[model samples]
Target: MQLIAHRGLVRSAPENTLAAFADALSCGFHGLETDVRLSADGEAVLFHDRTVATGVPVAAVTRAELSHLAGYIVPTLAEALDAFPEAFWNIEVKAPAAVAAVQTELKPRIERQRLLLTSLRHDIMLSMAEALEADTGFIVWHRPAALNSLLYAAMPHAHLRTLVWYYESIDLTLLQQANALGFRNYVFGAQTDHEHRLCEEFALHGLITDHPEFVGLTVTPPLQ
Candidate 1:
């Protein structure tokens, strides 16, 4: 089971910031996962949520102005890449344009084995898969009802080899069914030791977690 650093081991530092991501890398995390959204100027920035929650709107600010916000500064995908050179990244593009922008900025730096682009939107994911020529793209499907439809649509294609469905709880039955239907990667449950065992049992390629160090410690028992 591969342990992914969710938002850069959010427990230790600010979520999705360069400081937090650097900590995850120093802590020996296998991979780093972060969300990407488009800025006001159409730059691919590393951030989650559809909009800024409490303070000034990110979309209203320039990249330089966004860097001066309270807790976390909106970092461009390129900034993130420059910050962490050796770490592998799993970037979740929030929408269509964000995906395109990320592809534009990060394409040259993305060596085959180091990056995995994922999204919740089916068409966006399919389009990204096609554009990036990736062998397998991770799609985040939340509701159970959407799974059948998504799989149905993706069946005709060869590039999409993985499906990452999020849920409040794990239904092994559903997981089995999904795999039976040809879904390659099934990411479920919380970040826990028990979940690690479950991931191992299912032969999953990766496991998402809020804390990357926990996964590194629990799954592989770090090298001395």
Candidate 2:
């Protein structure tokens, strides 16, 4: 199974910064997952939340403003990709608004086979799958039967083959149902060893974890 670093490591540096990501890579983690959002200027940047500490929406601020308020260098999606060219990335586009900017950035990099673009928005994931082909996309953070009826119907099951579910939302029955539909399962938000062990018990395909070096995990390189 693949053990991707969640927002890199958050050990020495703030989460999602280049410094934190570098720590994960230096520690032998080959898969890195981070959230992507569009700045006010339409620049694709790596950040986790919809809002900052002052509750200002990230989309309302330019990248420079965000960096200053955030108290850390907020790296662009391009900068992260360029700095870690060899690492496999799970770039979760956080909002529908980011899809266009992200698509533009990813189009030329498609041939690298090192990216898995995921989103909580069904339309966004489906759009990427349709545009970039199936394997490069994952519908994120939901149980299969719980997806929006209309939106799920619009999803091409044969094209998009994977789901990245929150750890709490998944169980064997849910996973079985998803597998019945030909979907591969990956669990996210697993921080403890027991939680990580639960993923192993379910025979999950992969998982995203804050601590990639946790015990009982094989921590293999990501699919390239």
TM per candidate? 0.81, 0.86
lDDT of 2 by residue, 45-122 (tens): 999999999999899999999998899889999999999988889889889899888888888887874888777776
- The local lDDT score (0 to 100) that residue 30 gets in candidate 1 is 76
lDDT of 1 by residue, 173-203 (tens): 6667767876667474466767666666766
Report RMSD (Å) for each prediction in the order shown.
4.1, 4.8
Clashing pairs in 1: none
Candidate 2, superposed: residue stretches over 4 Å from native: 134-158, 216-224
Q: Which residue pairs in model 2 clash with each other? A: none
TM-score of 1: 0.81
Error of 1 at 6 (Å): 0.4
Alpha carbon deviation, residue 176, candidate 2 (Å): 2.9
